[model samples]
Target: MSASLQKQNIVSNFRQISSNKLILAVSCYLVLILNYPFLAKTFSAIVNSADYNVLFLISVPVLFICVFNIIQSMIAIGGFLKPVLIAMVVISSIIAYATLNYGTVFDFAMVQNVVESDSAEAFSYVNLTAIVFILMFGVVPALFIALAKIKKQSILTACINRSKVIGLCIIIVGLIGFSYFANYASVGRNNRDLVHYITPFKLFDASYKYATRHFFSPPREFLELDSTPFLKSSNGNPRVTVVLLGETARAQNFSLNGYEKDTNRFTKDLEIVSFLNISSCGTATAVSVPCMFSRLSKSEYDKQIANSQQNALDVAHLAGVDVLWIDNNNGSCKGVCNRISHIEISPDSQSKYCDGEYCLDEILLTELDKKLKNITHKDTLIVMHMMGSHGPTYYRRYPTNKRIFEPDCPRSDIQNCTNEELVNSYDNTISYTDFVVSQVISRLLQLDESTGSQSTMLYVSDHGESLGEKGVYLHGLPYAFAPAEQTHVPLLFWQDPENSSFSLDCLQNQAQLIASHDNFFDTLLGVLSVQSKLYQKHNDLIAKCKGDSRIAFKQGYGIQTNEETK
Candidate 1:
């Protein structure tokens, strides 16, 4: 009797263990909603953007899945994945919307990876793998059916569950200590050093010199305030010169010059001078932007740093002229804003966590009239550099309503999507940029009515983007091999309609004349009528305006004013 009783007890315990295993499996399966780590980051980012519609849409499915999964687990049920599949499809639309509305770093990552590998086929294969993964996701439901028959009595729990635990452990260890492979076994104390870990090819930057320079660079005090006004000169009184130093703007997609789309509709009315031959010195902001302001060029940037003096801003300030910088970029790239009074147009609002997708490009223009009127001195120079066409997430670069094309990263990986979709997302951004520039110029033209002064708005992008053309998307490759698409950019200057010097007839001639950034220093000095020892008329736009004295030095692949336009 005792032996029989023990046998019964053993059988009962085995049954209970199996029953419990079934319950836990069902419960954990519900947790599968949390399993796809990528979805959380993507959804969270959209919910926390400038607009709030997406956040609301995601809540419903999220609620349904949570409740249904929990109840199904308690009931020891299965077959709820159909609804989950539907949920992903719905969520993808919103994700697609978010992606289209802003710029992402995926393309940059792809290109940087390709360059590091020196492999065109690597990118192509990486793209192929993403498409295969997406297809695999669609068939995952059928594959899970075998789980219904598997014995759950073992310690492994489930293969997927074990994998998650292992992945988390690896992530923690990686974050805590820089592995041996890390170029520097040190993480930064402040401002998290994710860029070092990223940035293609594992090459490390010691100081985050590029990023920090935007926020923490020792200020060069490049420009200053002027105390006086200018009297009438040869062409009446001096006019306002608005120099727009575009941030991360690529010219290959700019419509006014040669893009296939109508990206420059807003600027259509003003004088349009198209220069297809312009280019930038470097890709990284610190290396190129500050260098552009400094006396340094591409080859001389790093080496000339200490010896360099008298930047473009300082020269403008010393000439007894009012110089103001209206910025919509990341905080003057870190104190690059010190000397000039700046307006922060980059979003400070984090109402939505993923607000980086869309830009507040309109923010800088709001103060245009007030800033212009506030300039107490004559020969005032205003520099506005917008956050233009910068992206890996091209879809996130503009607003949803601005979307002019379809099938864009309607899916996540660009390679997984179509080329037309990529171009469409990019073209939309260009359209918005065109409108912003045009609106700014239109407003400037209207100002002459009240101030009784002449003004000119000059817009030039810092650099260009690749947009999957030549297998590149973003800028900042090693300058040695940066394609023409990355280096060649757009340059435009519109004289005050009322100014006597203003004439549309001169635009074609003005644009055709090759001009390099080398002339930027002297050209700006001449335009503002600033008199200084720092200023040399040896080669200036004004001298060219007086006669044809401008000289565009064709330095290698870059354009020039003359010199054998070779």
Candidate 2:
């Protein structure tokens, strides 16, 4: 043969690959290339110089390779191999970018956030780094896979080969487990989140579970907690409770909660009282927001159950209080305000507080002013959802004037920025949030003075944020493994005493009590004085300090507990 012909023949032979070989090559590529973050984390978290530890480390990659190839053998068949692998490459690249840059885990909650986030919020994550990473790792590899020459196989031959691959993998896995069962169990028990760090597998598993629960399940029956809930207010002086629903504000960063930085300078001197120790239900808004509104406790909270029930807002609306939700955040109220009167402030809304991509939390105050001018009910509940400190665009959350912390991060690729810069930007958002909360208190006080009415301000963040702590930049780890920065949140309350019976001193005393999102529903009911069969007295933080028996009721007064119903 001629030299050029021989070279061409070699190239062609190298490019041609059978189905099983293709699956094996792709699985190895996934473990070694696309799953760099997972491997890096494993080495950092579990590797040591011990003999068994070294053996366990070596077996990790081998085990993953066998298992992944087995999965590919089942799914990536004759005509489907290229397309399926291309899709995996593309999606895994994106997931890998998030995991590498932000230490994100593609858990069920994170998947829900991605699936439900608005276009503006989603686009905030787009940047030069993401583009380069996806292009190099995702699109380029996908093109190679798509263009590869995959040899054909008959149905029977394919099935036999696939079964062989599966059997071999299972046997290999069993041998590894049997030989090192003690080490595996010890490591797994010690580092419970290690398995969740495995890329693509964990990501695919979570996506499938989310899809099945949200799309494949039968529609749950919507249950109303109370049909005849009544507002038991003092002499109807148009009681107004402005529930300032904050976003991404952690208690650890607040000066009111003992942080050295004066992040709460705007509201620190006001009549607001900060709850020193407050935990959120979940580490992400998609979970915590709906859970906060539901009557379910954190231990019992389920997304389907929360979505298919009458939340605190429903019972309050049914009790004759005019409820309005003004959302300035990028997302909706997660069905919390679906049954009530709600207004969504567009990010593109032509307002001074908006910059065409994300409106400042002050936009919520603009809507609040408009809602206050036209009060239609003697008792009202206004939920102002503030876009407070949502990141990696924390710099965009507040304006230039509100940049109280100097030398702040100004870019979206937050991992590249210094920790000091990131914290400064985040603290500025909190400072701006403090100003907004102070303004809400000011407006409520004005309403009380101008109309001889009673008004209160309740500010609670949906979930806390992670400011590059232990390499974790954003929220949404599994709740069992989430850090304090992602779970501990701030809760502030301010009430006008002239026209209302609730005392600020009592609230200040109660502020020291440890609480969680479980208190939110019953507390809202207590603040609005809404009498309902769904009211759980122990969960009502406000009623504990009301100093009245009517505000106090025994637990499980008007309804069956969730356990009983089950």
Candidate 3:
């Protein structure tokens, strides 16, 4: 073979490669054109992160599209490359939706393992995430690729029968995916049109030039607090109130609520009120806890935090509560400093005992014991926030050895775990929290008995937890959409029995009657002896149920109450 012969072979190979590249590029444009509805909404969110982790996780959807595209290509060879291009678009859309909404990067392999080992019931809800994946990454894209096949290729114009058939198949399937996307992206009645945005090409621009736009940035404002009279106790000394904030302690699981679980041994008689129909402001602690403490209702917590920004602690202090906060949470968000006294339980170097991954609420009790000594005056309010049933890593929230209710029948993962196991873990946390809170109540009672001073205890959780209802786990969903699990938390009050003012009958009635988290602001005002200037008289649980409040559930949606809306 001479030099010319070798050069000719190389030139032929280059032409073949170039032709394939052109075919693939053209296919991508076709899919994008066919599926414009889903792409537009998700684009900004996908590109915002401009991250490597996001791109890598996107492979799942990519593979889903690839499988569908290959099938279409095999059946209709005319536009074989179209399937691949469409797959790319769907994958990018996933990254766009998940990223835009501030979804965490999931460890798919670990999650899969958890689901596999656990009994089917154990991880039932967790598998919903998997379903979420298949839909976003699989079903919809495949539909497009399949439907794209509808447009028949011109047999007369085509030379290679195989290539032409594949190309046409690609078009038909791609169109199918688009039709589904149209209904899905629209957020309609049944489908609810959960749409995702972002195309592969846009994601590929890691330099983030596509994300760049000439937009105005909003100026951040400092949070403003309201002045009130919620500081002084019934006795009206210096006024110190300790609000123990529990996480995910649902009333259903408590023995106090008549559940078989002996979890609430601590709250046996001291007077507990079940805020029967009360709902959470949000699901995630990051969202709900801060939102609950915010002056805004669940309907407007996010909006209020976004624009106006006033927190419970901030207002309590301004009202002269001598607001002192000690948190056992993972971190701070509401910025409960500036105005009140702040003590971070997780970070305090002086904290001798608890360590690693959110403390088992007991630590707050111990810290409060030490801190209360300094509150020699009457009006000192202490807020203790606990890390309750935060999901996926429930075991991490509490010590494994302390897990009393085994075989736990413990499933390996979120999807695998049974409702019972999930509830058990949740109950165990509640049990531990009850023990700690009861200790505070008992001690306060003892202090009152010993010193001839008045003392009382109030306990409320930020929000409730979902076991596996409607294929959802944990909490922190948007308030309008959140389930009963996210909204209904436990509220109980324990007072010194010696005090005639601690009416047990009224307390029991309030527990069985209708109430809202909104009452937290006002009822505390009544208990603490200071009349809240901001208090609304309607929903105040103590005030409404003074004799026997019959209203069982606040019937409305998105935080609008009969009391407030009118």
Candidate 4:
């Protein structure tokens, strides 16, 4: 044969594989190569532990390979196999990237975060390194798989071959499971989160659940908590509560919460009560924002249910409070402001505060100033949703002047930067947040001083960030295994002393109490003095100190009950 003809024949032969062999190979690749992070984690958990033996460790990979092959055998058939494999390879690569780099799991909430995130926020995760990683592991393999030719067989033959392969895999898996049942059970019991780290399996499971819940589920019925909420202010002073809903401002990074750094420099000097032990409802904005706003507690918070029910803002609006939601974050209000008057601060806004990608949170202050001037209602609640310390482009969150910490990580690929540089960037965002919040309080204070408007500023973060702690670089981990850095958020409450009825000392004392997003719904109503059946005194953080606490129904009109509001 001629040289060119021989080369073509060799290449063609190399590209061909039996259908069953291809399925087995893909399964092995997924379990071993693509899931290197999962294997490494499993090794660390099993072999490194004193309880597991070498035999048990060896069986773990074997068990996974067998199980994965069984799964692959069922799916890898006809014309669908290559396409499915290609999709799996590509998605697994992205999941692996997140898992290996950020220590993130593809849980349902993380899937929600991905689905709900805007293009700007999503693209923030993309970089040269990530592109290269995906190309090497995902694109190349996918292209190869797509181009490969499977040795075709008759329907009966293909079915018999698949059945044999599956039977063999099941047998091997059964043998391994039976042999090391005790070891597997012990490890599973000890490291419950290990299952979440398994590549493709956890990712696929979460994606399926998310799709079913969002797309296939029945429409939820909307339930109004309070149809006739009323403000219980006796003195008739105009009430204005600027609830500065923060984003990713962790308590551990705040100076007011006893952080070593002076991140809260601006707000520290102000008469603000900082709740040191405040836990967030969720680790992601998609979950936390609505959960915090709804009357549902963290334990009972469901996104669908929360979205279907009336939130704190709705109750405030019903009570005749002028409600305004000013959003600076790309992730809107997560449906928390659906029933209220809201304005999103577009990145394309013709203002210096916006830089075409993300607006500095100072825009929230600017909007608040404008809103303060046009306040017509006696009771008003303005929610300023801030993009505070959101990563991996933490450097972009603050201005240059607010770069109080030196040598900050300025890029989105923060893993390349040193720990100090990364933290410096994160802390600067917090400092800038402090400055922005202080500015809001200042504007509110000015309004109070001039017109005697009863203004209270509540600065609470929707969630916290994970800054390279245990290799986790961002938030949105499954809440059960999430680190404190991802849940312990900062909450600061500041009310104008001249126009306030609640004592600052009392609030300051309550600041030391362990509070959470559960207190958020009722506390917001308490700030507006909204009286309704949904308002629970115990759930309200400041309800104890308010003047109406001594009255009938504890100044509001509800008993503190754990029953579902509907």
User: What's every prediction's RMSD, in angstroms?
Assistant: 15.7, 7.0, 13.0, 6.3
Residue-by-residue lDDT tens digits, candidate 3, 1-566: 99999999777655443223333433453334423433333333334433424443343244334433444344334455556545654564454333332231112211222222323223333435555654765557666554442323465544355455456656654664564444323323332222222233323342233123112334457655544444433444333466877776776777776779788787776555555556665555545555555566756655324335555555556666666677666545345443566777653334444554345666776778787666655566777777655455565556665576654434324546666776676666767777777788877776666666556577787777666776556654445455676677778765554443434555666667766666666676555555555666665667643322222222211223345567
Q: Which residue pairs show collisions in model 4?
A: none
Tens digits of per-residue lDDT for model 2, 1-566: 99999999899888888778878888898888888877876766556524347778788789889988888888887678889888878888888899888888988999998898988888888999999999999999888888778666788987898888889999999999898888777777777787787868798899999999999999999998789999885774788999989899999999988999988888877756789888999988889999999999999999999889999999999999999999887748988888999998887888998888888888887888998999988999999888898999899989999999989999999998999999999999999999998888889889899998988889999999898888898788888889999999999887764554555556667888999999999999998899999998888887866754322121212323344568
- In model 2, what are the clashing residue pairs, if there are any? none
Q: Count clashing residue pairs per candidate.
A: 22, 0, 63, 0
| Model 4 C-alpha lDDT per residue in residues 1-566, reported as the tens digit of each score | 99999999899878789878877777788888878877887888897666878998888778888898888778866888998888878888988888888888998999998999999998999999899999999999999888778887899998998898889988998898898898888888888888898888897899899999999999999998778888885576687888888899889988887889998888776767888889999999999999998899999988999999899888888888899999999939989888889999899999998888899988887888888899898888888899988899999998888889989998888888999999999999999989988888888888888887777888899888888888887999899989999999988888766545566556777888988999998888887878999989998888778783232221222333223234
Off by over 4 Å in 3: 1-187, 196-217, 220-239, 303-309, 347-353, 409-412, 418-420, 500-502, 544-566
Local distance difference test values of all predictions, in order: 0.52, 0.85, 0.54, 0.85
Worst 10 residues of 1 by lDDT: 193-202
- State the TM-score for model 3: 0.63
**Candidate 1 to truth, TM:** 0.56
How much lDDT does candidate 2 score?
0.85
Per-residue lDDT of 1-566 in model 1, one digit per residue for the tens?
A: 69999999777665543333443343333333322333344344445544445434354234334443344333332243334333433333222322222222222322333233322222322334444443443335324433334334344554454445445544543543343222212212221322222211122232243345434756563232323323225444546778877756667676777677777777876655565566676664544566556545556665225123556666676566677887765444333445666675545445331254334566667657688667576677887767666555556556677666665664335544577887777677677777777877777777777767777777777777766664445566556556777778777766653453433444455566655565566666767765655556764543444322223211211334344555
Instruction: Show where candidate 4 strays beyond 4 Å.
Output: 1-15, 48-50, 548-566
Q: Compare candidates 1 and 3 on lDDT and give the better one.
A: 3
Give the Å shift of residue 352 in candidate 3. 6.9
lDDT of residue 76 for candidate 3: 37
- lDDT of candidate 2 at residue 164, scale 0 to 100: 87
Instruction: Give the C-alpha lDDT of model 4.
Output: 0.85
- Specify the poorest-scoring 10-residue window by lDDT in model 3: 548-557
